[model samples]
Target: MKTFLLRKVHITVCGRFKLNDMHILVNTRLLLPGRFTGVEWFTFETLRRLVKWHPDVKFSFLFDRPYHQDFVFGDNVQPIVAHPQSRHPFLWYLWFEYSVPKVIEATKPDLFLSPDGFLSLKATIPQISVIHDLNFVHQPEGLPWLTGWYYRYFFEKFAEKATRIATVSHYSANDIATTYNFDTNRIDVIGNGVGDDFFPTKEIPDLLELDSKPYFLFVGSLNPRKNILGMLKSFELFKLKYNLPHKLVIVGDPMFKLSEMQSFYSAMQFKSDVIFAGRREGSDLNKLYAHATALWFVSFFEGFGIPIIEAFRAGCPVLTSTTTSMPEVAGNAAILQEPENIEGIARDMYNLATDTLLVDQLKSKGTLRAQYYTWDKAAERLWDCINKSL
Candidate 1:
């Protein structure tokens, strides 16, 4: 390998470098503070670990808006704010398609890393997009027309243009290759990691009041694709069949029109048993997961189910869908049920709640399974991919 010494002090990779000093640009648009979505969590955690591990590389985080000091870089890292804050949909498209190209040209980054999938078509640098899923293509009716159209149109082009594609699961990679007609050989599978914060908690704090009775948890956006209505229906059936005294706890913000869930939410015969706890962060979320009887996440589709791993880490048994990437991610550690089988889902939930032996077995297996994923491991894989591509 060729190497170069810079400033008579620093050593840099010059030719066919194996993950040595290189200028890297990571898109931080999804990592906005106070808006910590799943993609944001992945981006932030992976970037943080990458910078820490590779001190010689020059890392630039490109953000559309000014970021908090906590997210600011260290010695070899820097933040480059390229565009003004624009939450409007049209402005967002314009910023990415038009304004971002200018920023890329100015930065002259070796590679452009986008965690949110789509990249500027005008960019000259090699691009890597971390596309989580293609739900918009498969379930277009679940999202707004414009949103689905944007994803279907842009993602295909992005996949075609990108030098290398990295996805959270093999299932997603296959879907992307099939849908966009891109070579699957160019796609890299880098699974997501669960943070250390999601482990089992010994003390259930009184502030949460989560232990008054057994309850099932569903911790994700209240979107149609998540199969929230199916889950609700299944829970209602489960209550009737088992006559169990339990509540259904939802812990995410509504991601779509509230009207979609109103009927199911209103039709609950045991309306008082259902609770919308809103969004919980940090220890609150961890505690909630730890105390849950079981986590029910039978979504219609997924690129990768990060919450499945989260529940596993928290020692909470998981009952997830067998569709898409869920089965792959959950393996045999979780109770996999068909997304359409409301009765089956309810049965599994009831079993997990009352079956101590089964619960223990699941917990043990899940903890072992969760050991395979970590942010450090993901960062290492990412760095290797970048180096290989370079």
Candidate 2:
């Protein structure tokens, strides 16, 4: 958001990549400071490495609002704060279609990279879109009507027009390819990653603050597609049948269509046992994962479940959905279950709570699986995608 001027540097040769002459105009609208969601995390973690790795390649980061200096990442990154802040569906259209194009004209980079998948349809330059998933397409009820409509209408066009596409998992890659009928060869599979901070704890933190009770952790927005209702119901069932001391700890702030979840929570007999530790991060969030009984992320759909790997990195066992990208990300490390199977989820919860050997095995597998993903590797793959487009 700082007012810094950039001189347009043109490449004299076109055949091969010249690091000094390359300028990539990135749609960094999702890089909101302090509010790192899945997309924002992806953008921040990867872009941080990208700029550092290719110091000679200029990266023009287009932001709708003023960005934090920390996000500047390196001297190579030029942060340009453009017009109206894009938060709503209408504003999103205005920012991407109108505001971004003007910035594109000014920067005139060789290629454009859109991490959150919103591309400038008006821009003539080669564009690469990282379409994480088609979650909105599969479950429209999870989003606001206008937001859903915008994604359904414009994303296909974005995919078709993009010079290259990048997605998190093979499942998501396949979903994007089949949904848009896009060529698989042009798509790059770049998965989400875990930070070093989320490692296994040497000893469990003091449980006095949490009533000294072991708890199942649920992380992610309390959106309908995340199946907040389903998770609550399953936890209620587990409490009812077992009457155990274990509690269900819910993390993350409530997002979109939570009236039903509220209604269900009111009717539950063991509602008091469920703790809503909203929007936790840093060392506290790391401790929550490390000391939890297991991570219960049974979301109905996902492009890729980031918490699965985060939990894996923290040496926490996982119970996630079998559908979509969960199995692909979890592999054999997590206890996969159908998101709709309330009874089955309850059973798995019981298993994790009681079985010691299973926990140890899952922890070992999760640690091993966690090694496959890292921000460094993800950034490298994304850079490769950018290289291909150029």
Candidate 3:
């Protein structure tokens, strides 16, 4: 239906505007020099493919600073450093309103592509904004009050002004529609993909110097929404109930509510059993996933849970949330647990550890499910979404 509508509209839009003259200005600020967070990963992988696939079109990537050559994906790509890197809320407003608009004026782009869901209200060009979720709107306490205000204020208008919207999941598409009253039909769902590196490894490789006990993996930022407290409590419960030799390895830096988690972690009797593997990436994270007994990612909300698929690709059993996009993404390949229910989470954790048959079944199901998502496929969908917006 979306493709039909897009193709019908593209005929008229394409007739008026020559494809030969199309120059796309992408907001590549999310593609920081070295960092590849969830959003960053999406932008990089998709943009790399888009640039390669469309040589006829020119892609002018807008960065906040002097970007490294690593981010410059191709020859037809022109990298422009926009002023005022938006680290703070005020800086963000300045970057979008002032710096981004200024470049749009000079570049005179045929269309604008905002990979991180933030479209400049000031720009007159056609735009496609990839909004992952409205989590900030739903859970205001997840961010600072001012940051929350900025998201609500700008994003409502951003949704209104965008020519089209692309999201990571159908759940997020509906959430954005209900929250901001946007048309759901205009939204395209472009889900996430796990890389080839995440596949099952026969040996754990003794990476990160783990003690020999089997461990359940919880990979996410230490935020309130991640339910870190729940993970800790559930791990403790699992330890007490079964007396298993499994350790809980949490791999991510603290954010959102660090102090609250810090206080809780200090008081736990099984605190020693919980290993803080810290923020890891590439080989370190992949190895961690491959070796784990199961993946525990019962977060409160997610537009798409990338780690669930990463675990799936690693042939790891998954224990994820029953709500939001988790059940949608995990399908029947995981053990569903209510994120808030400590007892339920613990039971699933225990079940995943003990039930070897179930573990093997989930692993088989997950590996097959994981095969469906790939960057090449996502990039093709994203390209279609971008073309429709024009």
Summarize candidate 3's per-residue lDDT along 317-369 as a digit string, tens digits. 99999989899999989999888899988888888888899989999999889
Count of backbone clashes for each model? 0, 0, 0
Q: Against the hidden reference, what TM-scores do the models get?
A: 0.92, 0.94, 0.93
lDDT of 1 by residue, 1-390 (tens): 222332222212111212445888787876766678778887888888888887888777776765676775566667766554546567667667666676666556788888888688888888898888999988887778887887888888888889888888889989988888888878888888998789899857333434488888999988888998898899999998999988888889887765757887787887678888887777888887898899999999888988999999999999999899999999989999999999899899889988999999999999999988777777777777687667
Clashing pairs in model 3? none
Best by TM-score: 2
lDDT of candidate 2 over 22-82, digit per residue (tens): 9998888777756788998999899999999888998888777767677787877777777
The TM-score obtained by model 2 is 0.94
Candidate 1 wrong stretches, greater than 4 Å: 1-21, 205-211
Q: Locate the minimum summed-lDDT window of 10 residues in model 3.
A: 7-16
Roughly what TM-score does model 3 have, to 2 decimal places? 0.93
Higher-ranked by lDDT: 1 or 3: 3
Model 1 error, position 272 (Å): 0.8
